[model samples]
Target: MFCSDDPVQLQLPVLETGFPYGELEELLSFLQSDNPTVSPNNSGSEGSNRTLSSPDDRKRRRMMSNRESARRSRWRKKKHLEDTTNELNQLGAENQELKSQLDYVASRFFAVQAENERLRSECASLSARLSDLHWILLAMQNHINPR
Candidate 1:
């Protein structure tokens, strides 16, 4: 068949010739295959019944289990590290935001205090001026009437 200009068909894996049932079937069958036998070399019913295990078999099992456990633990640790990094970044951003808010509030509070001080000083000065004016009026009235 002449090649069509479809992009979907072009991205497929290039298959090499001369394999049993092609690579796809082999891959599918392998993925669908059951777990391996516990004892691969041992064959007969007597072999099945025997309790004897070779040192090599035990070593292989131990190594496989250890590697699997280590691999899983490593991936888990990687996930945890990534999570921690994300949390720390979020906390840092929040902390910075809170700090900015605090600074803004502090600056506003100082401005208010300064305004209050200025208002208090102005009120005190006005009160002093009013008292002086009252004293001057009383002196003028006493001088004018002799009582």
Candidate 2:
């Protein structure tokens, strides 16, 4: 097992097909090997007691790990998108409901305003009729008394 006490780790170049180190023969063998144990979904780490394997083996393991990480990242992104979309849909529905309530309130306000105006008009008409009757009563009283 190679244990590094250094804080800064060395960066390795990611390779897709060809070997970064000039080991064409090892690369060919690694490519031909159908190892189902190197599945991307395999979560277990190579044991803590793992001795330094060949470069091809390390590269293959790294590639598998990278693929698994990418798969998980894509899954998280998809889930986040779904949750956001659902929230947006819910907010849209709530906004529409609020707009409907506002419209109903506005209509009721207009109806009340119209009723108030009608009542004011009726009050003014009644006031004018009462004033006319008071004057007629005064005139009749003055005529009958000759004052």
Among residues 3 or more apart in sequence or in different chains, the pairs in candidate 1 whose N, CA or C atoms overlap within 3 Å are: none
lDDT of 1: 0.68
Candidate 2, residues 23-123: lDDT per residue as tens digits?
A: 54454444445332333443445532233344657787689668757876888899999999999999999999999999999999999999999999999
Residue pairs with backbone overlap in model 2? none
Q: Cα RMSDs of all predictions?
A: 12.9, 13.7
All candidates: TM-score: 0.62, 0.57
On the 0 to 100 scale, the lDDT of residue 90 in model 2 is 100
lDDT (10s digit) by residue, model 1, range 1-147: 223332222234646533446645654444333222334444676454433444555665578557656876888899999999999999999999999999999999999999999999999999999999999999999999994
Residue 130 in candidate 2 has what lDDT?
99
In model 1, the runs with Cα more than 4 Å from the true position are 1-53
